[model samples]
Target: MEKYWNWEGNYIGVRQKDYLTACDGIILGKFYGKEIYDQNGNYIGEIGKNNRLIKNKTKENFRRPGFSFYVKGTITAPFKSCDPYPMIPGYEDFLR
Candidate 1:
């Protein structure tokens, strides 16, 4: 499994240690206090401790319509994991 980081270069979370065996590279694990951002660097939300992507509701109401809300959903995209390569180096330091 691999780790992930936020746009501010902060450690966010890590893929489940045994994620490879469980889901073939899919990420599933506890997330630290990390804020998620959109492509334009806008604050989106944060991954909760329950491994759910909790979107920032404060910003959702005004965003473009038709955008799927992930407020209480888990990230199901298997390719969205931070494995193979991480945005920032040493993100695994928080694992300990």
Candidate 2:
């Protein structure tokens, strides 16, 4: 495992495991409680699992640099708002 501090002093952890798997695991843990079932649909022991197809697809999309960039590249205005949309910090380079 490797650790680094961001400019804001937030400690970021890096694992030897693949980043995509780690991120999916994180999403699964956040959305689904600790319980996974086997293929037979039996109540298996508790384990961090991702059962949502949409969420898993999103994770896959985020793993691709181009796909992630395209999704984050543009901002859509609200249907009934004049307020300027907020830009993602450190994404000024992308905008240019």
Query: Which structure among the candidates has the greatest TM-score?
Result: 1
All candidates' lDDT scores? 0.35, 0.21
Runs in model 1 lying further than 4 Å from the true structure: 2-33, 59-96
Candidate 1 displacement at residue 12 in angstroms? 15
TM-score (all chains, Cα) for each model? 0.29, 0.22
Write model 2 residue lDDT over 2-90, tens digit each, in one string. 22222222222222222211221221111123322222332222211121111122222122111121111112221221222233332
Q: How does residue 24 of candidate 1 score in lDDT? A: 35
lDDT (10s digit) by residue, model 1, range 1-96: 444443334344445432211123223222333544343334445544334334445544332222223222223333343323332332222221
What TM-score would you give candidate 1 relative to the actual structure? 0.29
**lDDT measured at residue 95 in model 1 versus the true structure, 0 to 100:** 20
- Prediction-by-prediction clash tally: 0, 0
